[model samples]
Target: MEIMNNDAVRNVVNDVSDQLRRALFQAREVNAANYIHVVLDPNHPVAPFDSLHPDHLEQRVPSVKFHRSMRADFQHQPELCPLVVTLYSPGDRGYRDEELLLETVDNAVSRCASVNGSYVCGWIATTLNGEEFARHIAVSSILSHPLSGRKVLPWFEPHRLALIVDRYPSFAWSRLTNISSWWFVDMLQQLRVVSPPEVGRNNIIDARSTLLPLSGRQVSAVWDDQRRIREAKLVAMAMRKAGLSLPEFPEVTLDKVVRQAYENGLYGQQDVVFFAMNCLTLSEDWFLHPVVQAALEALAGTDELTLTDILAGHSDAVLHEIASYESAGSAPK
Candidate 1:
């Protein structure tokens, strides 16, 4: 891709809109070319157009909303629902801004790695000389995950998930800190391949409907459910296998009970990792941890067995036992 002259690119952007011009100008100063421009329509298509060949514009292909959320959490100027994402790719360039462009693209794709409903419309810009050349590239494939263009809205919106953090402080902190885009995306993909764990079984009544309805949290939970339940079941089964016998546990359900228990300090973050690794049939390091074995035995002794059992008790002893076990293990030994 040829680098468009600064003046020429500026003129093209300015012609599009003062907003676009200003955004690009500010971003250009930092050497970034890709951008997300939120407009009235997320589905609007930018037809392919070459300034050098303005008469030969390609057809417009409809774009889809790749991610959807209301920007209500912003302290200032919160946008309402139906925010659209417009990935702006200014043709490839070798200027100092190339790194910024590449970094922006990487960040955008990685953030949308878990998106399920989005379509991509191609955009191509080829600069020739001191003039302008741009085109709206079109692709037939649905751009569901890892959009190459910069995502301009929704995913970047601030959220109100303090309740979740409050409930699952230990789990949230550790998971958030250790999250890898590749691993998280891979987890989402794996969830899609397998059947979602049956809900409303194992005496674990689905309480999602009764819980405080938060769209943002609900959406997030839906996305990571498979990871949550898979982690929960593995830990539960490990407790049983370690000869921590108790009454029969409820059937595994991909719901808030299991999700909340794990998130709400019923288990350690590494326990989830070990559970996940075990699911892959990877290794046996989890078994060697004395703390883990002790925790399992302690858990087996509890009368309330199901995930629902744990959640029903606001600050239950089982949670304390698990937390205490993890805390003891975390200390220098």
Candidate 2:
């Protein structure tokens, strides 16, 4: 509940790793507070799947891995693999770079908001916006259990992702900007829930084996998935119920949200808002306008006025505050 301080975020990630070990031991639970697993294909032309994480860490907990391609499309991508999540939680001694790391996260979030060219921006925003993540954060794998036969990896830091943007331009950014926000959110949401969608039923193919074999385009297909469509509908409903203006783009979509980050660069895009907003609406994860969220957070427990009232008006300072935060790990706080 405290502001997502570095220590707390680190603790949560640590807990997730631990939960992963415990779950694998008794096959009981795989919460986010513990550990997460990343499955790699033995035949894939990426990092070695056998020795990704250090041995000392594994000795600390019981972990499992199901070696095979997932039916999903991200199976073979190495960059998305574990990519070294902070091994120890903030509670542990390993969180030495808590401040710096948090700054990194801050930068990532801000950049995502500043740049509309990526779906991750909305996803990160939604993750920071708890209640939406509370129950699901504990899931061991991004979409399922670590050993769920699907390859799993750590989420990428924004700056880290941005650095590589120039490298895989046609590949990564194209996926982020060109795709629908709902699609990423839907897939992200689905990954946390139960088993992935069935690639083929009756004929009985293991989701574990085929999930990753999916081509980049196939994985990206989640952008137009039925689940994604459903998420879009829900977002539209929330906005309508809130009496907020809905985007005129495709009915109830994430293009609006991604566009907000893209065009206006709510985090600081200079003026890409109008263009991006033209393409999308809301992401599956509803990161209400930061101002809206701030008003609600600042009000804390007054219970007197509604959120609509709080965010209805703001001075220029609010804009500056937002700018500072978007640039660094939150204004000089």
Candidate 3:
């Protein structure tokens, strides 16, 4: 019941979001079957979907799994259609529907590599549309597919989209709902910076936590002082409105953030896990930065405890590296 209720509310939200997006573009709704399609020229900067033309049927070969639904067939039958979509659903009670989405999704995913949150994958129980429509995000990258002898760099991913969500919620939703190009671009930027699997997993879970409270460090929420000052003022206003004090800090450096998390038990648990595990995801061959590797070496291999331990503490100005990496993993190739 709780899940269902949430779904019902989300449906309303999605619908409202959709309506708002449409208005932003003054977009006309087209032939929406199992998915939401908007009419646009493929060359247009915002086109998100590409369809098969009824004329060139012979050259396209969608796999069997693509047959799970009419929509999948429509997308993969591959003659050439100019229609593109932002959201799609497979609509089968059976897994066949989901399978079709996954299969057909690959067809479209190439466009989503840099997306923000992976197109909000999987059914979050009770959202009627998501339940049947298997949504897949497209991404763009610079990677070469070794097997195909083709450079298969992705253009979008979900983590990339988070910033868009953070910056312009209305624009993000509208474009995601109205124009695939704009939204996909947001996703792509995130994909470019996405941490590796181990890193991503660690980023979300609190591996070292014991009595520590669950914390959500939203790097996404971090902002420049200009924004922060406004935010601080707004927070102060809200607190005054509620007869409470605003969330505060004298500064917003990395050390300040970590210390705040430790003191209030707010941000570090999951982030610590993320930092520890992220070392594995990056390319094995190191680059110029050796801060992380140096730290690990200092902590594990060498010296007496207190001497290096205190030196390595966040406050110590001894070493500097990319904010994401704490210790250098290895020597640069």
Candidate 4:
């Protein structure tokens, strides 16, 4: 099926908009949620039902309905409906239902894309007659991710920094903790950045293509300052928790480590993993920043350490180590 032109799409949207509104309105009245899938081709070779996981169509709520409709029948069988709207209860399932809906829709669209022709796809999320959380209807083909199977609509991926700020809660908290060790890692785990099998084929995960600024030396002062400040704050918090009396050094300190990191070319995403693995294992080289070292030391010999640990360890020893090192005018060797 070829992609519908602007006028053709507008006509299709007008035809289905009322049906969608009615379904949404009914769903709201019962305090349930619904998935409104509007696909352009009624007889597209791919079937929506086949595209989704079996569980999605199974009865998991008070009611699950699949409605299909179109203008006219092409052959003997009723012309496949261009609109397949699945109305189901979101009652008490948290984000699971939402995830399933999107995943199923995404799968369907993906299969359809493999076929010839153009098609438009869209979905909406709304509370029972109460409020609409999101209403997105875009050309589905244009909005696709690099990764094949783990697909999500836009605003769902933290692939880009701005997307991370907008969609990642941990990012906001990281600002307060000043720990950027996980920012790049989280992006990878979340599929914001796709990794081809070629890198892992050699037992090496190279992200040079996805993450920018090949090295810390390439980082701007502003970015460096922001990263350093957070790292320092996190280290200070760890020291304080380890029973060490230390002043908040958000505005100062950790410069030596940060500068060293820049000189050592430790600004890439892989550099983050390198530092984290070393810190976890307490490696001999100590490529991590002093703040990171202090943070790790604060949690030495623990199965699971939390921010609270920063206040429970041997304070005097921790304080003496930090202070003596500073007083000696030496950086960690």
Candidate 5:
């Protein structure tokens, strides 16, 4: 996975923080008591808490709690434990503390980037009180597997959390916790939000004893989601290598191109990437052209030619004509 550079990370974090601040103001106006908490993975080299000033650390209002203390196995490994710090409260008089906490989170995320991605997962805003919210998140972190018994689920990690929300049924996830909204920066360096399904809001589980089981099918779905995420990252990297500026919300385009590649039986990494590059370079619907479709069909019937070989064989005039057609069709009449 490509790690975002410092500037890119800072811009994304600022955008996310702005949105979170707006959420806080909106909650205050409605007289709803909400708390914003930043969750830090201690496993990261520069944890969010480490970025905080000594005075900020000593503050009692934005209290810090270890999620691992709620579980036995994680208790001894404090260094590996995840920390949740309350950043904002409805009762706060000013935004100074919240701003400081956001800055610390920004610095933490910028410094924690590895080849895999940033370890600073993100923040959460909820109506539940601080202690209740912490307990609920702790309970949700443990998953029961039939074969392995009980294990910790790093569902707080942005990518893993995204996969869970994308694949698991709303009722299954919503019943496990009482989070109003979750905000996280995705692998694409884009801010994303996950909220409880409206229908499942009132059905939250209240006790730690009611742990959700990790089914085989759900596990498989998560794996599939991970594969798709990897493919999107690959496509993004390819585009960048080619000096192509990414479109806004490029993940949406990347996902479509990757899915189209799979649908056309281009399963090999080279074939899939080649197909995606062409679609991204020309048009997402480029393969739908009659000439392109015929070329794909002919290529599919033969093992002699790869997608790259077949597509690259097209004359410059023919490729240009296809691109022109797409451009014309997309134009306002």
Candidate 6:
């Protein structure tokens, strides 16, 4: 997969819209129905469902219909519920009404952007009815964990789809695929397709019964992925707070800074974020200074001061002196 620049990230909505149009056309050619699976974020400023007519929402399988069996608490909330919007080809029953609804949905999806907190995560092309399609999504949403019993994995989240597809085992992918294909916008803001394995194409077994328990390795990997995501968000927040743009602090540089923070025994979210914020404001190698090194040692020792407190205790002149030394020494001679 190619790494997308900031401009390409901004074009993700258009890319997803184009993919949905192509998927609809392909589904029609194969006599299949298209179902859009969207997990609504209650905190998002814009509510996509609010723009749709009541009748259009009525056409969708009610969130309760599929999530009634799931144990997740969020499933009970109407705003946080996952919606499966069904779209049928022309001449199909209720096709005219669906066409109008599809236009509204398409517009909403086209406006989706991670920067704005996108709610539309993925779409499915399958022969299953709306309820059956939703059932698949519900079962796939929560996975069986060997030790925890059950865990909710938001694999459908656009930013998480690539991680799930690349890191998760084959069994997980088998359960995620629908009759036709699953379409999602990956973390890179690029559209991706996952098709059902040829051997399982004819299998009609219930997914709930076949849900595989995550292995110990899978559990560790999942946790690590979650941590990295949190760390990335923290880094982004710190950059914004420092008034630094992505170009000024590219992903590659940000990743190195995060790794260095971890290497320096800064595991706590606040400490890691503080470390990252300073690295951006100062130089990435500023910690090599004796003042910064002493602070890190104090944090590692029995000192009562937290890393944030110790760092903030330093005078602006002292911190700038450290940054100036590091920058001058690291400069190309």
Candidate 1 lDDT over residue span 1-333, tens digit each: 112366754443344333323434544344343333322212321133421111221121322222232333332432222332333434534233332233222222222112222112111111111111111111101112232332122221111112223343333322221111101111111101111123333212132223222245543443454345444444434444454321222222213344544543455545443443332232223332454445455565564453333333534564344333433344453
Name the lDDT value of residue 22 in candidate 1.
47
lDDT of 4 by residue, 123-201 (tens): 3333211112111211111122233322222221112232234333332222212111111112001111121122233
Clashes of each: 8, 40, 54, 12, 0, 0
Candidate maximizing lDDT: 5
lDDT of 2 by residue, 1-333 (tens): 112467754565455334333433321122223222222212112223323323322443333222222223344553332222232221233333333333322322222222122212122111112221221222222333323344432222222223223233332322222111111112111111111222243212232231223345543432223223333334444444454554433222344353343333232222123223322333322224477456546656564654335544767686445333332232342
Report lDDT per candidate: 0.29, 0.30, 0.28, 0.33, 0.61, 0.56
Tell me each candidate's TM-score: 0.24, 0.25, 0.24, 0.22, 0.64, 0.62
Judge candidate 3 at residue 150 and give its lDDT: 29
C-alpha-based local distance difference test score of model 4: 0.33
Q: Which scores greater on TM-score, model 4 or model 6? A: 6
**Best-fitting candidate, scored by TM-score:** 5
Higher TM-score: candidate 1 or 6? 6
Error of 2 at 67 (Å): 8.8
- Once fitted onto the true fold, the runs of candidate 4 whose alpha carbons sit more than 4 angstroms away are 1-52, 59-153, 158-271, 276-333
**Predicted structure 5, TM vs. truth:** 0.64
lDDT of 5 by residue, 1-333 (tens): 244577876777788667767765764554446667766665554534554533345564545532332543566776566656667667777553655557645753453223344446666666656577666666666666565666666667665666566557552455336555677765445567776655333423344445555567665545455566567667767776666766555545666688788888777777788788777777656777788777778877787777667657789988787775564356553
- Candidate no. 1 TM-score: 0.24
